[model samples]
Target: MMPSIKFLRIIVVLSASLLFGCSDKSVDQAEFPPDKTAAVEVNGSDYSIEKGGYRWVRKKGLETETVTTDHASPNQMAEHLQPISVKSGQKVKVKIEDNPILNVFLWNQSGKEKEIKLEDDQITVPADKGTYIYEVLAEWKNGEISYTFVAEVQ
Candidate 1:
């Protein structure tokens, strides 16, 4: 048994060594205490921080939920495209926002998935325009994400 002061000194030395880099002949595990790392959960993820317009994690096993920035805040985002409703054969110039990671899929009551091509962040929908219900899902780089935006096109 060693004095508490002496034990503390050994701990400090071991911590400094680990910070620089560990060696094959490692010190006693008791000397170096384990870090108290706690995961922050938010949006259904152990991570709760945003960086580079994306969510990140210090370790892997932790699953994270992600949503495209545009879809994440359609109401607050000015560039987000609002669902369009036009008369039959109206030929509206769909104004889509340009988002490289935004996966926009137009689904109608017909239960069909139509991937709309993005040009200038918008696409013209050639719907017959008869009170059609459509759902737009905007996906981000993270699969644990989805933005369900619905609109009625008449």
Candidate 2:
């Protein structure tokens, strides 16, 4: 009877360890959504960015999930936020955490979008003086996020 009791104890310990080990590994592999701030720099000054719509893939334990959220367009998103004043044709630096792949666009008031070329993590603002909405689409291996900012060219 004593030998049987000892065997049962060992089995329970081994089972518990295996369960915890698998859980820990899953937690390590799980990728959480982005919680960091994205910003833009203009002439050595940094401005905060407003987060926009996103489609992300999240993993937890043994389950995988695709999470997507829709928000207003870049031009509409800019309406609620204050615009950052910048000189016309100034070089604005894109600052996103984790250095994700970035695709930038310029949005006119008419709801049209034009892709802006990003050179060395920086984009040149429009040459004309007006208010423009900018969208920064950032992507990682697991997810993608859209960030918006309004820029007023002086």
Candidate 3:
């Protein structure tokens, strides 16, 4: 029996479609090469680090899915702050490991918790041009991530 013209076209189209069927992979799905970074002194002698150096260091893994509901965290991403020192009233940059830039916050240390925005990675807080311990609440997927670091108000 002879197939109709439409049926023949359909079969041809299907055959071509199969030829173009996706491979078992995609560019994005392909395993990315491991990342590496250079070590450098940050904020002078106060601290030193390598970009994206410390992360995913656990025998187990985390399963938190619902992302960044607030700006807090359970632990420190690093033992030292990115820029441990900064001048008070002067703009300083900072970033919490595995967190967003906007997630970083500044508290006045005045009993009342005031959240201030950051520039680049640091926030400017007006101090008496001396030394101070600023409680910075960095943003995390779970809540307000806090870090106690010293900044000199110069």
lDDT of each: 0.37, 0.87, 0.43
Per-candidate TM-score against the hidden true structure: 0.33, 0.81, 0.37
- What are the root-mean-square deviations of the candidates from the true structure over C-alphas? 14.2, 3.5, 9.4
Which residue segments of model 3 deviate by more than 4 Å?
A: 1-85, 101-110, 142-144
Task: Give the winner by TM-score.
Answer: 2
lDDT of 2 by residue, 38-130 (tens): 999998989999999988886665789788999998888988989999998999999988889999988877775789999999999888999
Question: Candidate 1 on 1-154: residue-level lDDT in tens?
Answer: 6579988999999999887775544333431111112122222333211111223122223544233333333222212434333444332222222232444455543444566665543445455553332233333232222333333346
Clash-forming residue pairs, model 2: none
Pitting candidate 1 against candidate 2, the one with the higher TM-score is 2
Q: Pick the candidate with the highest lDDT.
A: 2
